[model samples]
Target: MPDRLAPLTEALLAAARKAGAEAADAMAIDGRSVSVDVRGGALEQADRSEGTEIGLRVLIGRRQACVSASDISARTMAEMAERAVAMAREAPEDATIGLAEPADLARAWDLALLDLADPAPEPGAAELQDDARRAEAAALAVSGISQCQAASASYSRQRVFIAATNGFAGGYSRTSRSTSAVAIAGEGLAMERDWAAESRTYQSDLPSAEEIGRLAGERAAERLGARKPKTGAYPVVFDERIASGLVGHLLAAINGSAIVRGSSWLRDAMGAQVLPRGLSIYENPHRPRISSSRPFDAEGLPTAPRDIVRDGTLKSWTLDLGTARKLGLKSTGSAARGASSPPAPSISNIALTQGDHSRAQLIEAMGTGLVVTSMIGAAINPTTGDYSRGASGFWVENGRISHPVNECTLAGNLRDMLMRITPANDARGHLSHVVPSLLVEGLTLAGA
Candidate 1:
């Protein structure tokens, strides 16, 4: 309950200065997690972990090096700083390697407004196991489910603090609770499996285990008679569950790191139309109770809402300090990092504009196509935007789902795909990526 992470970060920064580094930053994270899994109506696995980790990044001249350790002792902090400084001395000079200026650092954030950490006490392993068991029982209760493969419940809490020689210092804590279930339908080679899961910042906000499990069972039963559809060019609807992947590809294309390397398909598309007219991609990092919501980035810079794509045009690239400097642009405050790694450009919460039509309405209008509920592998060409992936879901005919389909491929260029999408107003607001189901036209399907 005491402030454990802040003192560790302060000590780490002090050690870095003592080790003769020109400048440095430190991060300390303390985390605890408990998870329980149930199978065959019995507890199959239970695990718990608690630990504290400290990381130091030291800069000498234009070079920087990072080191991390789980040992929280004063001696280890000093040793980590010394080792980081030594590594920095031998590293290649990069003008972009530096900490944020004091003026640029975030100050006076409202952690309470974010409501990241749940106020309730942590659930015990017995409670988690009970949740898992209930989920499994609910899945087995479904009519067509052959078996409940696995059901799980978990809770995690993490406290993170960041400090730098440039006068940046801030810390926050977050908690997550989740429940999931996997159900199998049919028998032998005809068996199909599917899962349902939900996570929330607060345990009270999480959906009931029975609801998650029943959904999983229903999904598996829906895939019982899957067969490959005929090969041809067809319209495809990426279901709301999997639609985020399509938008994720766009996020990657506009990433500053990819742009700086000139390896992204959209590297030269800053002002070009990337989405259909009237569509936009927006990011917000301060949305209360969302897992990715943060007042400040890993680099201690303030994060704010921004439109990555505005009215169908590429408006901004996701950037951290290093990547922004390399591209002669200002940082987007999108930096994210782990204890053992340097900060890199990353998105927090993003949403694609929802359309007026519902998912059912879109399917009814499609006439004949595939409704892709799940995907397996990818063969994306980052630079050229060529995209292909294994897909499985329902085959639609006469504007109605005819049957389940599997073992098929969907191929198209990402750039072309984005330009031809029709969004459905079915995005779940609770998700970090609030992308609605997207319908794409003229994609080549490889199947029977």
Candidate 2:
């Protein structure tokens, strides 16, 4: 921990104690990031940023309050602490709100979470510009690729530290690298554009510039001369990348805040069948190659693999300390935190169990249906499970992909969709939610 930050934490803790606080904690984060963008084979924009912030939390009797600041001076820390205590004093008391007891802290897991010594790569401006230019140029060289909208690369590094009055202190750091390219195909009145993006925990995992460009070009070229399909109900196939978004939606509905506020459709549905048989979903904080892996959760709760849904049945709801206390249930160790905010429930590396059928079998099983490649715009109602989203993809005919479809909307209730899930073996683990290509029996698609 940085000496400057440690003193700030100490000051906040001291202020809380002086104000008669029962518990207190502070968290700080320092991070830096850079981005580069290229268009028409030219560097268009480049930027870099660095930031640091601290957050303080205090508990007075049964009330709790929190405050945050970018200023880390002793005076600022004391003022933030006083603000937290005063706010706690003014707020209505809640019987279940308090910090985790020292005894509740988990034995430290010797995970290599922080790579502090990893040398930050000095990716030169010329190198970034060249990378983006080469990617865009490669996309333009591909057959059937007529134009490139944009290409870019980004690198970022972040460090975080947490200190609590209950003798819990820890910090970790990670780095990320990403590359992406977008291309448009066809000409005149029929133009289609698509993009491909790749990210990894370390810079070494990034795909070569040529590979990324080729993928983007191929995706766009395939969408050339797209047409709209007839409106009807049919089986739908979701690509792994897009399917992960659906999983994220479901996870949001199962968060502790949603459950406690009665805003989630899954509320009170634990231990009940929520999806089709043979379907399962779980959060694995220890999963390798995932950016969100952690030994402990944001609230200092020990994290372990937990099944959220098993064999079509709801198993548990994600919980933070407050929600767990309120519900009289043990904390699920799913807490997540931002730089200057109280901890909230969040799943890490959600994985959906794959089935026996292969990708070919799954696609073949869809005799005549929409093969959704992308979902555009948000149209999910978490509280009601109602969903409608703009979609784009190719049409499957006679168990084979025919041509791309455009200007379509897929509408369905998530509850009904879950019940109709039939998983395939094409599960991909690149994203946080590793799900297979899913086949839903029937969905309403509106198209011209």
lDDT of 2: 0.82
Tens-digit lDDT string for candidate 2 (93-147): 9887777878888658755542322355757667767778878888888999988
- Candidate 2: where are CA atoms >4 Å away? 1-7, 113-122
TM for candidate 2 is: 0.94
Q: Specify the highest-lDDT model's number.
A: 1
lDDT of 2 at 163: 74
Query: What is the TM-score of each predicted model, taking all chains together?
Result: 0.99, 0.94
Q: Give the Cα lDDT of each candidate.
A: 0.94, 0.82
lDDT string for model 1 (1-448, tens) is 2388788988999999999999988999899999999999889999999999989989999999999999999999989999999999999999998989889899888999999999999999999998899999988898889999899999999999998889988899999999999999999999998999999999999999999999999999999999999899999999999999999999999999999999999999999999999999999999999999999999999999999999999999999999999999999999999888999999999999999999999999999999999999999999999999999999999999999999999999999999999999999999999999999999999999
Pairs in clash, predicted candidate 1: none
Cα-lDDT of candidate 1: 0.94
